[model samples]
Target: MDLSDKQQRPVPQGPRIDRTFFRQNKKINKINKLKNKIILVRVLTEILLGALRIVHKRNTRAP
Candidate 1:
């Protein structure tokens, strides 16, 4: 069957967790999870850096 034919086919009405499908889905899920984690870490790091900079500025001008 052609790729377009596959695309036009109706979605399965029941769960069919075959090996290849499971593997690919798991891989894609891991990639998405990792990407989200990386984004969260980056945002947190930026916020912490900004706070530290502000604190440093205040401390330097205190004395």
Candidate 2:
């Protein structure tokens, strides 16, 4: 039996996180895992923003 065009076509699935992507992702996950004495949404955002600022500064100063 011959399949129709739609039936023969492979269905696209959701995003698959590859090993390389997961490697960096794991680093972030680990960082987040290191919890402080207090855990708050505002504090988390501040920590992330501070990290971004340091990264931005380092990149801008790079030769």
> Which one is best on lDDT?
1
lDDT of 2 at 63: 97
Compose the digit string of candidate 2's lDDT tens values, residues 1-63: 322323233333568745665566556555554533245766988999999999999999959
Candidate 1 residue pairs in backbone clash: none
Each candidate: how many clashes?
0, 0
TM-scores for every candidate against the unseen true structure: 0.65, 0.37
Minimum summed lDDT over a 10-residue window in model 2 is located at 1-10
lDDT of 1 by residue, 1-63 (tens): 122322232333567645666566556666666766899999999999999999999999956
RMSD values for the candidates in order, in angstroms, are: 8.7, 18.0
Model 1 stretches astray by more than 4 angstroms: 1-18
